[model samples]
Target: MCNAEIDPKTVPHMRELMAGLPTNWGKWGPDDEIGCLNYLTQAEVLRGVASIRSGKTFTLQVQMGNPKGDPVWPGRRGAQRINLMDKGDFICGNGPQTPGCHEFADDLMIMYLQGSTQYDALGHVWYDDHIYNGFDAKSTAGGMQKASVLPIAERGVVGRGILIDMARHRGKDVLDRGETFNHHDLIDAAKAQGIEIEKRDILLVRTGWIGSFYRRDPAEFYTDFVEPGLTFSRELVDWFKEMEIPNLVTDTIANEVTLEPETGVMIPLHCALMRNLGVAFTEIAALDALAADCAQDAQWSFLYTAAPLKVVNGSGAPVNPLVIK
Candidate 1:
């Protein structure tokens, strides 16, 4: 599956990266949404659960239709509308039989599943027609019979969450949309915080872009500064696999540098990590509060769980990741 047209040396990681790209297709078998989640074994989950000493929880999800999110993609019109069930509807009707003693309230949201903070499923990204575990797109469409979000929901994704506070390292509230972070920076940040990259750990990078772009102003976030993100590099993915990290949570739009060094590859890391390797990415996470709490106590990690809606053949869904310490 190597692309021989381009010289291997031309790319950052060389031929080794190319060869590694197409692997893990059937590593866990033909039918598997388990993917890297397999790394988060019972033992790993138990450890994470046990770490919840104080029972303090922080929400990592940005609200639906949050001003911070960009309505750029088609069908991503933020939230169209929200409404509550009228008092005299199906239950009460025009003659309100039980109106005097009626008690009912309901609310609804017309939103894109991936609009706010969300967990992307294996089928969410693809290399041409194939997805993770070598599932062909046509036969394996998501929702029920494919690489759906169901598997992730069933797994009850709980693990140790490690926050690489890039903002704290730089003494800033948020990283500019133009700044880029590399593998070395990830390591340095971890070492500085006295946290070890461990198997099944959920890696969260606080770029601080959430505060600047989404929280402060929407117009400026979309039109202003170049988005600061991950420097395009295969080494980053390699390190993730080495550490057996299954989930990646980031407080940024795309997670990777908007304009990577390689001009053509808009988000090369996405294809490798999600489509090929089956690593789940939780994006647009509002992590400022969590980062501040972690920094305050010099705590770099927490026990966390990200449970997505059980959409049968869903490619992705909004998630409210809970972090407890």
Candidate 2:
């Protein structure tokens, strides 16, 4: 990990930094919203089903309201659940009356769509006044009018997922703060696990970062606040394009190193891969148990399916991805 302090002036603009990368703008169609998700064809669905050796399943979403506080990006509060109706309310004579004497408990949650394990809309981040499929940045005013998560939620994501455990490959419980890895490192880690990342596979990389968040102090966790994840590079972007990787999932707040060490750019991949190339990002997933099981059984591939809450014109949506191995 590079420890150099970042200077805002030295960082290049996103447009200048991502000058020559190829985009997926007209590949699908003029009205395409969900991007590389088109790669999950019927055959790809069958391929995922074939990888299901056992009946065991894992849910990749973290608990929404942890007593110790849920893990979230700085400045965004975690999900807050407040009871609207409960036995206590009935006891206090404040509950709604029912003709048949039926009572129920109800609660409401307030949170950022990206607050938990989530699927980011293709328009979630952009520069140069453009989003995925060249949608105007103005469509995001008030709410997303193009490339919103609703399309993704309606379509759903299902495919063969390959887990690349970076921490285990590097012999660490968790990668250090701001630790970075690229496509080459990903390939090496996949090789070490005796797995091949097939084209169009849902790429799930585990850095053990989220696992450590539970054990460490919240203040310390946010102190230098740098997530260990894939760093932006031209070759890495090319690899993703060539491989047709649909989704990139990780156990980090942001799916890439917070700041590019060399260019001092914040989440360049969000602009390069997501905005330009149209790759879906699933972040802050719970991959500890799944990684451990894969390590034990030596089965790194499985069927991955996720349907984020359908939110109209939303920038992102919460999701609880299901993994069957």
Candidate 3:
């Protein structure tokens, strides 16, 4: 059964824990040092903000998995295409009536994972048995009511977004896959881009990985090529906590520290951001067009908006985020 209730009394210590935190803008607060976890809900979101000055609205979505084509990831099952018409005859008046509308059907595969494109949610990752904002991972997985089950309403996200062009920082158009990015490299790139990180700003990092994936073969995109990603570090978390950023996103496969082949450990960034600080992360965002615009205008911060699909009990959903300068 769904527990459609928010009992602050049950978690009294939570309120006290968050009491010392600054509550600026109330509902429409910007990302802060520790990051804003509760601000994603409808009750705390800002609604009806002023219209965006820019008139452009671009969409960002990845092509779903294909059955006949190569698999998305190794060891994963290939997609399956189904066509209702091919299974049975369209008409059989004397013996059995064929399934209605079978004649007009087509074969297609459904995308099982919603995180294929620009996506975000609380259930996407977990640490210490807790999901986002102290939600128990076991309870949440067992059907307890939580933010993961809720819809990403339109008002939940409305703020200024900044894009850090890592490719530009390297003096190249893009970075290849398997290229590991470190903490100091990000700092240098930010400096080179002349972009100052700010509180409540949505940070978008571009490595040109997405562009490479689209242009090259699937094998080349996944195995032959890789790109630089933010390396997880305790100091980086402290910096974000001090800045009070609410959301952090990137145009990469996973928004965390890429595991070092020598050490063989997963993203430490997830540990610091999601577990320790409760900062939200968005992955696989398409920001090439926006990056170009920012380079031309010499401005990074812009009004941003994203609306995720209303999938119940879903880990994450595909999103088409927009930016208005």
Candidate 4:
């Protein structure tokens, strides 16, 4: 939360900045937890299927347990994998026996569910004692009793994903820290790529931040810790609602700039887009490969599908989204 460049005293609260914005609270139903993902209907799935031209598939999850360490939000460490049993245990005569002359290796991982590329539950963030769909924030007291990632996983997200490579569109390998863009910027990038972002399309915006993380030292990457991405604006929220955009996938840890440049509020879009509008967010996706391929062939639209782990009551779940072109 320590952004050196911005003065905390001058920042407005999320509630204050998001006042008067539209919400999708009852747009689906009172019992709804999956939110705007409902827009990925059967016809949307077929539309995604129809966008396939080259039959090339790209997996968008970053590698977990990389020796060089994984890219995650500051203050959160990378996944740790520890071996429980191996040949050394058997040689030491301390291994458990299953059958005659049988040996096995076992390992365990400790990580934050949101430490990797993940789909955040609508209940993942909130203000004013309520979560998405106006569910009592108390439901999250003991691990998200409502609007957890389980419902989203059960529903699944499959639709036409339009890639807006903002970094490439701006003629840079990566956007500068704290660089901000809006719905108009997204449209401009799409237009530059000669494609249109249609209604109900799963929007994937790449800033190249995640790719740069692996190339630079962790300390340098997290210094001041502001990410370049979509900024908060009433018009941006209106655009998302008007376009019926279902899911927002980005390569940044938080989908938007670390702090809203206008109000100096942090992650206001998380509340405006997820809590209010029920828009699903998939963060930390590895999109460089996909972006490169799209640039090579000039095909930016594809069939995007992701199935996050069904973690009951979990705030978020890691997912390896599959994009087919």
Q: Which ten residues in a row have the lowest lDDT in candidate 3?
A: 25-34
Give RMSD (Å) of candidate 1 vs. truth. 4.6
Residue 293's lDDT within candidate 4 is 98
Q: Which stretches in model 4 have alpha-carbon errors above 4 Å?
A: 1-9
TM-score for each of the candidates: 0.85, 0.96, 0.70, 0.96
Off by over 4 Å in 3: 1-53, 65-109, 140-145, 149-155, 182-188, 224-227, 260-263
Per-residue lDDT for 1-325 in model 3, tens only? 2132435444222223333343222232322212354443332233212324556555544445532242233334434556644434434422334467334445766564443564555445554465555556685654434545234433256565667888877877777555666556766777777776655566678887665566667765556323467764445656777666667777776765355333334555555565456566666677788788778877666666776666666666666676766
| Prediction-by-prediction clash tally | 13, 0, 14, 0
Cα error, residue 177 of model 2, in Å, equals: 0.2
User: In terms of TM-score, how similar is model 4 to the real structure?
Assistant: 0.96
- The TM-score obtained by model 1 is 0.85
lDDT of each: 0.73, 0.94, 0.56, 0.94
List the candidate numbers ranked by lDDT, top first: 4, 2, 1, 3
Residue-level error in angstroms, candidate 2, position 133: 1.0
What CA RMSD would you report for each candidate? 4.6, 3.0, 9.2, 2.2
Q: Tell me the TM-score of model 3.
A: 0.70
Candidate 1: regions farther than 4 A off: 1-22, 66-75, 84-96, 140-144, 224-226
lDDT of 2 at 127: 86
